[model samples]
Target: MCEWVNRIEYSLWTQHCDEGRRFGHMTKNISECMNSILKGVRNFPVCSLVKATYGRDNSEFTVAETTLTDSFSLGSYRVSLASQTCDCGYFQALHFPCPHALACCAYSWLTWEPYVHQLYRLNSVFSVYRMGFTPPISEGFWPPYDGPTVIPVPNKRRAREGRPTSTRIRTNMDEADPNRPKRCGLCRQPGHTRRSCPQLRGAEHTRGHD
Candidate 1:
């Protein structure tokens, strides 16, 4: 029965599965393979892991963010640095610049593209499951499996009983100011005519003043 199971497993692996082929549509399997590569790295020191992961040879150099021009083929939308995203789903979901944005940045000679991982990648998620494993203990440790002297923490300072006075400071106002009149929606300036606003109407003298 064990031999039969082994044969079956081998056969399954050798045979092509439709779903497995479909999984490669957007490189989903590649991400899963990367996750497996990172599995053993969880127990290692973080600085060491970073140095290893983003090492000179292994690093995937990316392009920088820059203004989109008619000359560049950026598809439908532009790269918005303020939002840290491109119009396509790439930068918004990943918090990393999309290929177009990266290309723009590279062309512009910007280096911010290298640090995008700090903004988006969740390193803590990998630590959670990796920390669950216990290290192998030395023999002759006995049933307690202990070595170091555990000390009861000494209280250095007494805990404060009362809350700070700043916490009790209260204000009478229940809502924001209501008298603040809406600014000219056109120019976004206060006390201005909407149609006459220079921004929306474009800068010009009234009727005939050159």
Candidate 2:
């Protein structure tokens, strides 16, 4: 299931999720995990993201039973043990084996560490950053300027030929931002949204009257 705010957010910050499961320990675990990750890598890239930022808590491996399956369910998790995925989306999203997957590993008597993506492993991350970066020399130390300058291109700067639709890409962060004064789609007026637009109401009113 999708959780809007974490348990720590509700219990420590605000009481939003009374019905939700309590994971008070995660506050410390998450903090320490992020701390270790930051200590490992400060930069981000598509390929290195999972490896530079993977750490499973000690809490995950403490599974109770010895049972393996293509599917496993307990509380919030709906894990597809075969595909190595969870309904929480953390597993596939990070390309690292999530807590749910690790739990399955424990039950199956399989080693938990191997289930995680190699990129997220400590040894892999440490190996890359171990090499020191060579310092770049100043422009004065550079070779003589020999290349021809190629720079006349106003035609190349023109916008692509297409009807430009006024739409912005929606991101997950947008959900947390405060609602803005929406513009009406019908009459193109500010202050009211498309749903509550007076122009739409007026049109409907006139149609009903007719």
Candidate 3:
């Protein structure tokens, strides 16, 4: 009887036990929640983006928990933070407080706007065009130099018989910048960068005049 009991316990442990069961897949769970939120929200055009140029208030905020209200309305779908957002699709996509988040704000009085921003809306995502600049006017005008000196076009070498004429070669122009100034990011000075700064290197003797 004891031997039979031991065998049964060993079989259960070996066959049924799993390490993954003990440790939950948090990443998968979060991804699934995001997917659910996306599916529920209605779609919006990407070009209909709002210009959020100026920075938001940097004041520190306290987080508040909001309870779901009965019979909440979110466009087509009912409101559910448990579902992570409403059917309107505002809460999840922007990651900032939407109308539903505002409702949550009213109930909790905990500043749902901050939560909407902190959890979902990343500043980095919006920063893509923050430092955007117009392309500089090219010094090389159209209808390039009609100079007198007749520079003959170099003739291509004849391809070997039965060999392909096409060949792929990498160019250094990718790394080379014509307009990029040879200046340092630190101290906004010219010549060596901050990384190679003598001042930073503690070599006072090597520090040159401004």
User: Each prediction's Cα RMSD?
Assistant: 34.4, 34.0, 34.6
Residue 31 of model 1 has an lDDT of 72
Query: How much RMSD separates candidate 2 from the native structure?
Result: 34.0
Alpha-carbon deviation at 89 in model 2, angstroms: 0.5
Best by lDDT: 2
lDDT of each: 0.59, 0.66, 0.53
Off by over 4 Å in 2: 1-68, 127-134, 138-210
True-structure RMSD for candidate 1? 34.4
TM-score of 2: 0.30
| Model 1 lDDT tens row, 1-210 | 778777664424433554444432344456775555566675789886676567532433322112333233456767655566677778778767778777766665666555376634466566566766777887777476467887756554444787533535557774567797767877688877787677754455444355
Per-residue lDDT tens digits for candidate 3, residues 1-210, read 777777764433443443444232234355564454344232534332111111111111112123433234545566655545666787677766567657755654545544455534567577766987898778876567768886656566565688766566757855668787777766677778989875676765556542
The numbered model that scores best in TM-score is 2
Candidate 1 matches the true fold with a TM-score of 0.25
- The local lDDT score (0 to 100) that residue 201 gets in candidate 1 is 47
Q: Which model, 2 or 3, shows the larger lDDT?
A: 2
